[model samples]
Target: MSEKINVGDKAPDFELIKPDGSTFRLQNQLKETNVVLYFYPKDNTPGCTKQACEFRDQYEVFKEHEAEVVGISADSSDSHDEFERSHRLPFVLLSDTGNKVRNLFGVPRKFGIIPGRVTYVIDKDGIVRYIFNSMTKPLEHVKNALEVLKNIEKK
Candidate 1:
């Protein structure tokens, strides 16, 4: 895998399919708001579910900070739909079926088996302000992202 992107790097842009079968482009989102982009291994799995739920629970906090949270995985749009419905996830869940976006972000694999879990806080100008990469501490992704966004909002 390529070296993990740094905090100040420009975020790689990608187009992904949303659970609703519509397409979402990272650049388009950046035009309006800062983005909290997270890459997870799969949908409905244990760790992934906890991470998603944490994001769902703190989604209002994210919005109040003027940031939008988006979760991505290699699952198909159909799977994302079911996962979103089951979890009542308010933010967008995108399908990166081929791991294209995952690779674009250079998210490493944990134990060389599952995709690495990483969260990125991208400012409105499309520059990444922070990256938290951890396969085990899923909920920290939400906490770290909120902290970064709160700082960004203050500046």
Candidate 2:
């Protein structure tokens, strides 16, 4: 496992496949707006779904703060497409096949099995400002991210 990414660290740039099969590069996104990069375990799962829906519900708020939400998981592009469509998620969902990005960020695995749930609030400058990691309280990820973005906006 790589070193765990921490607040104040520059977020590592990476490319992943979006639901539409287009490329998503983190560095390119940072040039436009702040990013709420969330790593979840799976698609269609209960906790993951609720977390995603909460993000969808607050997506406009994020935009108001000049942040863009992006979700990543080991699921495939087709699964991401279905999840986004079914949940009406306004943000992009990226397919992190083989959990490469997950490991890159050193996101933990629960019980040495389940993939961890983590949210990284990254500023437009590509600096990570906050990180929330919780396997049980999925919805808190959304709340925490919004709080961080609000704080970032105040600065």
Candidate 3:
């Protein structure tokens, strides 16, 4: 429940362990391209699976726009690895086991058990230009954010 950010705010820097045993630093990775960072609840579950698969479906478009997609969840690295493998996801899945990263991003949730669906579109300059939060229909968020990024670049 941190309300510390709004549009045009500098995106906070973070470093988390990726499922591949590599570390991801926000500022470093996003120095060139826009970032589509989505926080989901669990892997392999129906909602989460659909959302992830949708991202996978549009991976090439995100790449075409020079944007990188990353997913964060409270699940373990092992779980993330399994999910990635099962889904053939072509992007990074970071593990935030302690929920510290989620808290840092101020992702809303319920009962602290399920993660609220939130997507942040960070521009190349590391600023949060757009944020989309939806309680349901999380799978549509990637398309929404992608459209926003496209419109922003058109400007």
Candidate with maximal TM-score: 2
Candidate 3 scores a C-alpha RMSD against the true structure in Å of 1.3
* Residue 31 error, candidate 3, Å: 1.3
Top lDDT hit: 2
- Of the candidates numbered 2 and 3, which has the greater TM-score value? 2
- What is the C-alpha lDDT profile of model 1 across 17-123, one tens digit per residue? 77766889999999999999999999999999999999999999998998999999888888988999999999998887788888888899888878889999999
Candidate 3, superposed: residue stretches over 4 Å from native: none
Expressed as tens digits, the lDDT of each residue in 77-153 for candidate 3 is: 99999999999999999988888878887888877667877889999898898888886787779889889889868
lDDT of each: 0.91, 0.93, 0.87
* TM-scores for candidates 1 onward, in order: 0.96, 0.97, 0.94
User: Which structure is stronger by lDDT: 2 or 3?
Assistant: 2
Worst 10 residues of 2 by lDDT: 15-24
Which ten contiguous residues of candidate 3 have the minimum total lDDT?
1-10
